[model samples]
Target: MTDPYERLRAEAEAGRVEEVVVAVPDLQGRLMGSRLSVPYFLEEAARGGFGACVYLLATDVEMDTGPGYAIDAWDSGFGDFVLRPDPATLRTVLPWDEGTALVLADAVWPAGPGGGHGPGHGPEHGPEPVAVAPRHVLRTQLDRLAARGLTAYAGTELEFLLFTASYREAWERRYTGLRPAARYNTDYSLQGLEEVEPVARRIRRAMTRAGLRMETARGECHPGQYEIVFRYDEAMATCDNHVLFKDGAKRIAAAEGASLTFMPKFDEGEGNSCHVHLSLRGTDGTPVLADPSAGDGMSELMRHFIAGQLACLPDLALLMAPNVNSYKRLQPGAFAPTGIAWGRDNRTCPIRVVGSGPSLRIEHRVPGGDANPYLAVAAAVAAGLYGIDNRLPLPPEHTANALADPAVPRLPATLTEALHRWEGSGIAAELFGKETVAHYARAARAELSAFERAVTDWERVRGFERL
Candidate 1:
């Protein structure tokens, strides 16, 4: 493949590319940006950066901005922050979107009058990285790992439910009585996947063409749920692709007259999950998480990394499970972790260590389909570093099912609990700066507040006659 910039330039000159999307991953991991003409993008936005409202980093999922966030968009009069395009993330749009290319960007403060130097600045001049930005938050942790001469690689396996109803139809009916793409549990059953295969196949092929290496696609335990895994890459790049794939998958599904959701728990049945697989390597690319001579084939670094997960799981739950509905999927028997424990290839534990030698890694099963990949991966990296720095001891693996183990530590059972743990946690404040912690805590508060005020169907149904 040719250099991304060169290829884009050539395509644009030949009239094959017309528009370029400049996007930044918001707090909810949604791509928020504008589509620019290819000529304008190549001439100006590519280097000087495009202006976006600062609230992109400060607002809730509904784009509502208010007080108490780290960025405090309202206090700042909702000014513009620069979206500096990351050339490495440049790629052609999906198969269905013709004549368009997309590039992810970093949220940064504009250069001041004098232009001072600081961390998270642009290449030629200084423009501070929005400290609370999701991408910047993840980048901070990666930088910490780099200082220790280590690099992190990760892959995310996301599960989502497909509905035969179009998005507009689903919205019109308030998402009830809709037909699932698959009518029965399709777990590894070829016969039940007929309805889902066409859309899934299209998504897989399009993602491969977009430069994401496909690993596996399979039917899951739920009636309409499916899981797609992509080959792991450098942690940041993996997250970049993760967001792009999610956004594109939804668009493609809509275009096909179907709708898909990555919500953690769309219904009372099996829920969607995003299991993250992470590992460490030396700066030179030597695998550092595995040891062939060790009795268990686990290196000392691997033990500390696992220990860090146990130590930080409580404080960092907000990053893994951020939304109100997220906790609905983390309940017992939901196949979404309910306890804090680690085990060898154990599906029941939150941290499952798998593979061996160079392929060895930990699969963090805590995050659900709705998690922000950048924040969740950052939490993992931060916890691992804490363990390594403190020489934290790895405990005995929970050989039994962790969910049913009464003695095992419990993860926050609700989003409110997670927010309380995060807001009051000194560990969270230390790992991520106090400001970053506060910013996300406020985001969680907003979610909880919204849920509190809404009058749900359950409430109406239970009270209309019975009460």
Candidate 2:
């Protein structure tokens, strides 16, 4: 049983692979990239791929230059940082029409002779600097889980809405009298899915061709909404595939004249959630979280992990719900959980414990589909690791309504509160680093400032004559 790297190298050498596209997910969950030749990537750049500026991760959704990042500024000269390719993530891009392959890598301090290529776009010069990248931070958390003799298995349920054209087209038309890819709210309606079967089939086929094990695909709660479930894999791979999955889905959808949106709440009473299912396995591959005799087949370790997550849920809110629009889904009875509670098969609870065999795991219902998968997984894994390290006690299970039960803590009510909590949180700072945390907080504040300066149509409609 050779490792994934060896297999991928063989595949690449055999001419089974074409170009290698290097990518990292940006703030708005969009994959940003610069493609490199396979030979260059493998020989010289593979160990340390090309270096891009650190500001790539510092900006907002619009890529606007932001303020308050202590590391980068107009004066300090935002320098080039390294992107170290993770060969484990290499895969052939079967979904694309062209001959190409893809891999996900970590942005790190380039490790090469004579240090990293210094500052500029030129090659072969300078010394490596000390810096923390998002993926590297996540790898540290994953290493912590491994140290505890625990391996994590996880899955993400992707929910997204489909419209006929680009967002610009829809917005310019006032989103009125728009045509959905599907006709009605087709929750489990196979007939509706059939109407979009060409695109849906491509999504499944492409994902499978890319080596992702997809379980099911069906229509979701909203008119154009759809959901796809992937078979569980190792925690890190789960998040890696998620980024590729979204990119693949969107590309396939666009070819078929549809646009995929993972926005939390696209419209009033219409939202999509990315539910993550997670479990821990012992060294022998048996689930450590499953005990038939325990509460809901959940072991003490599982309880404590959930307890740690709940205790720090507020601080993790920013990671799970990154954008300003994401806060809209926090309202009750909207199928998105507002309170932090776990129960056996309870959809209302923030965490739902499911399965009975080795698959017994938790489904965290808090994250929106738009969350940056790297950051989201890192935050969750960090909290769970804290639980295992401290031997934290799990709270009593909540069988009743979590929202009505005042005992279970609720998520941050608004983006403002969430941002404040993220800024002040010691756990977040420790996990994400001062620079990363500060950059995101500053970006959020910039967005808030922009929103304050604008006057919306609603304001004029409600107060134009009265005020």
Candidate 3:
């Protein structure tokens, strides 16, 4: 792992790099920003950071304003938010514009008008970093883990469905009547993957060049859907790579004259998922979850962490599954977890404990394909840390099918219920910071409200014809 700035500088000096991009993940996990000529990026943005609209953090997926957010709005008049470049995230984005590299940013706001703002900029003192910003929220949780002499490591396995229609065509069709990349269920089917091999291979190569230790890329159970796997890394590193992986895949799809969606469900088909695998380590690099003496191969520390995640699963459900369609994928028979329980490598349980030795870890299967990588990790880590802090006890290992288990705790079934649970969660408030919780909760509720206000085809089909 060479310093990204140094690598970018070297590549630029060699005349191999032409463009540099400064991007920040918005509330919807979409990277929003502009491209800079390598010279300007190297001269100014690479060091001092760049200015972007404050609305990027305050808006919804459509970039429309939502009510009750504590941040910028029409009343306040949109202001500029600074993008502090993170040198660590600089990487090449291949198959994109020739000779292009990308870097993510930390959003910093002005302390006062023209008084110098954006972190690491201005006279001795300058702009303050927005603590509640998505990246900042993840950093806060990781920093907390480090301070306790523990290392948090995780990986995100993203599943998405590819469409034969190009992005423009998909848009023109309003995303309807599009065909899957493949016509049949292609779970582990190499021949089936051949249909999307070119697209999948291109995405995999880009991610590898950008530095994701890719584990596998294969078709899952559903048609048109595929999964890309990655080796686990430290929390921040894993998430940064996940964001790039996601962005790169979408870019590749658009370039290849195809389209896709990471949304939980695509109409009457199987759902996508962004399953996360996680574990903690000691400063000495020991697997903290492993205990040879324990029957289930989990130490007391690991049990407490699981207990914590279970306790907070409902509280953080909104962060995990943020959209209205998200809940549609959480129902039983989808192979998605509907109850809060742990099992030994069990796919039916919300928490799956796997590996008995050094690789011991917990897989949180609660999130849908649409979860924000940074916020999702933040929610899990914060809950695990809280569990450690409070010594929460693990519930009984759900040896039976969690879907049929009556005594097991059930997670929120709808976006509205999840929001209510999130609103009442003190752990979420404490872990994500009160301001971050309120802002995100407000945004989540707004999304729910908007969906509620709309009239859907289901309603029309049920009521329009007869009554």
Candidate 4:
């Protein structure tokens, strides 16, 4: 196998690569970074790292920053954080964008006096990773699991709705009355996908060229909605591919003169979901999630892992459901999860155990499309660790529809409730340091503030006619 960096260097020398994008995943899982010239990237940035605004990690969807965040960019003069590119994430083949290669980066505080890349800063100085950054938050959890001789493997199934109208048109119309790619429900229908298949095919092919292994792709229940699942990998790599795919998919859609949305609930119909499938393995690659000797093929470790999810789902809800729109999809009858229960092959339950032997894993159904993959996966890993450390007993599985069972404990019903649970729970602080909890709590509060201050179309239409 050719070395990824050497291959990139050769491509740059041959004029086949012009730019290298060094990006970091923000709180919303959006990639934010700079595009460097190939020569500059291969010479300087790749060795010493690239600079990005610290606010990238502190801001909300609108890029507004304020106090109360762990980073507190405004108070700190909105300084810069170094974006250290990870060689493991380098992608040399981007079929969608020619002459461009992309690499995911980690946010780190600058070295030397006053935590700035000032005088005395040298290659010998070690920069500290930003603890509250989304990538680091996930890394912390993975490190915790590793300490216990376990590694996490995961895959995410994300769904989105595609529209025939271009993004510019969708924006001009205030995102209403646009034409859907499909006129009706086309779940698993090979016939009606002609409208969406063209753009979908481009996205699928581009992702494969970008190094993601495609597992499945098909239409979803809602009109214009589609889902394409990729094969599982190490937890961190899975999330890296997820963000890249999302970013590339939008660019591809724009080039195709179409628009798609991954918002949890676009309307009253079926909503988008990001069901996370997770399993545990030993450091040496031994699968430990299943035991054939057990009647159900669930290992003792697997039982505790499921137990942890039930115990911590409420407290960690904010991580999985980060936005107010996220709760709109989690409501009952929405085909998303509402109750905190686990069952074998149960879609209605928040935690569903499936597969057998090495394939055995727990599927967490709480997150919607709006979720930040790193944070959501981190919550799952942390919850499972909690269960393993305490040896929490697995509760009886709800064989029936867990969504309709009033007896089953419910997940946080709203972002407000989720935030309250997350901030108040000592378990959340323990699992993901106090700084991480407080940082995300502030983010959720920012989202709520933004929503409260806006007068929506629904409110205007109702009052415009009534009064």
Candidate 5:
């Protein structure tokens, strides 16, 4: 419970720290990094580490580096920016080599007047922050919550596949001979999990030892897939823990001569997702959702929040399913959700109402493992807040399949459609601002355009000979 920044500094001073890895995600949601020695990190880099231009958060998974960005290009000289460390996220790297420390940074618009922008910075569309910086938006939303004398607690289920080796090796083999950690569909199968006991057990322990509040690890639906749940905590802390959990799992798996992937769907039969569970509490520490003898045992406040989530679900589609490939997992009959519906403990529904006593809450099943946790939380909180303010009506509980019934409201089916809906949405305007939506639309359009241009193996193999 000590200050993470202070702990990092102390570790560095005591010679217990080795490398300090400062990372910010690029367009593909892959963590990019610059490693620094503990001494230099504590002295200079810890405050504001150096980073490259707008391309970091603007490019696609291929690092293709160009599309819809109006910010940077070959003609723009591809300037550098500053990655300002968020001291609150500075934590010990328990699973890394020889006492390392890890810290996450906020991408600053280090170019503009009054001197925050980088050197030789030209005129931009103003010194606005990048839209892919989800954590930044979440902080803004949390400030609003704090102002309302409330606190947010959250947890997310990390579902991923454990392959026998690294992605590079699997790709080289044409994804043909790769094996899942398990042989059978494990869904709560003890004997099935026992087959991959080493990987699962070590993952839990390593994450727990690294200061993550790991709850339990369980076998998932597909062969070689698993899900890990953690105890919920303050919203910010939970996001921090989620990132650490992913890092620890991948490191542990690699150490065992295997690889772990959070890809939404690695195979046709099995898919990975990150289901986020959240609840709100008052300053006096009372649950907002609990009210026995009420409908679904939910209070008026709970109903209002749920209504807001449903009404603004479309606007939030981009955050919940951010990547282009994410839409593929949202199809019906895949155990994924594609509609705006809630039910009592039903995983098939996009939202599930849980708890009977003082723990009542909603669990959103829309987000995949590829989602940005900060942005997802921001979208949820914003929508819920709108519900509370407007007192929107809660729809009837869904008993049947939501996506199957055209009457039930459904979410966008593609990233491009979602982006268009988001741009015109009042929720996006209120929560993220108009300019933010416009900027992100540019990013989304570029990604979609690039994807449209690339011919896939399916097209080459299926149509090349016949068509």
Candidate 6:
């Protein structure tokens, strides 16, 4: 068997592929590039990259032109950005778009005109920076780690709620009265999984076929919610797998005549969570943060990473939970952290220090399943690096209810607060470039503004007759 990479290279070079999909992640983490014929991919895109509008970064999840963006406006003409395909990431998405191999792309600035010979826009001097793209942000943070002679590996526990209703049926019902695959809380129950087995089986097989490494699958605290854990890989690959797996899962579930949502707090029952587990290793392949003799077997480096997360959580909250509905899931006692705190093997804390030896890592629980893994992971890495660079002290682990402790800083209680923190955050700006921070913060504000103008059923029912 030729390893996957060799197979991809052979196929790409030999023109054996049909549709070569070049995908670049937008601010919302949605794959936002286009499908090209293999000839165009090989001739134009594989090296030179295709052109796309830069406003893709500014658009909200609703596709509304996001306000307050510093670039790509009516005045600026929404200039073209280069979608630089990374051929190394080419792989067949067998379960969904079979016969089509997809390569992830980086957003860069297009050259002046005909080919690379356009005046000053040579290979060495072209404007290739994608300052607002999430992948670029993650890559920047990863490079920071590399500069320290360290590499970070991360694994995410992806959770989503499965409903018996088909997507159309659920939408017609306005997401009401859809049967949960399970009838009660089924956390870690083998029997509980049986209830959602068909949907689960389809998802598992799809992800497996797509080459997503499945580590474990289990039920969560809610009736129909389940979590699939993947093996940890380097930060870039981990986040890439996260996005691909999620897109694959949605497609497979819809195909199976079932529907699932990663919406945090699908009603009041349970909020889907993507708990992140991360560890650092030296460039030489030795673990840097695990010391057998240290407290909880965590090196000072690990503690600093945790400390960094604690300090930066508020500013990064909007990036982790981009939507307004996401904050509703941050309620206390919902298996989600409400404050910035850490504990040894504690689920209640924002950062949970767990395992020992080769497994020594911290599980960051701040992000919802709705998070764009690229941004979330990037924020985590940036915060970790900040902690290391600043030599910030990791506070004593919290043994009590973090929400009840007034001393403990709360996770930004709303998107508004998060945007405020994000705008003023020196750490976040320093971590993920100031311009990128401002761009995303503007998008978040736009999302918030849209939410506020809408009158929901609850609003009408509560105030229509009473007032």
- Global CA lDDT of candidate 5, please? 0.77
Name the best candidate (by lDDT): 4
User: Which candidate, 4 or 6, would have the higher TM-score against the true structure?
Assistant: 4
Give candidate 2's total backbone clashes: 0
TM-score for all predictions?
0.97, 0.89, 0.95, 0.97, 0.90, 0.93
| Residue-wise C-alpha lDDT for candidate 3, range 17-45, written one tens digit per residue | 88888999888788889899888998888
lDDT of 2 by residue, 1-467 (tens): 65545554666788776577877666655667777877777776676577777677667666766557544535436665566667788786556546677777666554444233323222453333323345655667777788878787788988988887765676677665567778887988877765567778888888898899989989887888888899888878888888888888888887776677888887785688988888889867878987888746678788888887887889878878877777888787677888888788898898888888787788888888887776677788888877766788887778898877777678997889999999999988876678778877887786777778878767987999998
Compared with the true structure, what per-residue lDDT tens digits does model 1 show for residues 182-242?
9899987778988898889989999999889999999998887898899999999999999
What is candidate 6's lDDT per residue for 197-284, written digit by digit as tens?
A: 8889878878887788898998888899999998899989988888888877887788878899998878878899989899999999
Put the candidates in TM-score order, highest first: 4, 1, 3, 6, 5, 2
Decide which is better by TM-score, 3 or 5.
3
| Weakest lDDT window of 10 consecutive positions for candidate 2 | 113-122
Off by over 4 Å in 5: 1-6, 25-29, 48-52, 70-76, 111-132, 293-295
**Runs with alpha carbons beyond 4 Å of true place in candidate 2:** 1-17, 111-132, 166-168, 171-177, 293-296, 430-433, 463-467
Off by over 4 Å in 6: 1-17, 113-124
Reference-based lDDT, each prediction: 0.92, 0.76, 0.84, 0.93, 0.77, 0.82
Error of 6 at 221 (Å): 1.8
Clashes of 1: 0
Cα lDDT for residue 8, model 2? 48
Indicate whether candidate 1 or candidate 3 has the larger lDDT: 1
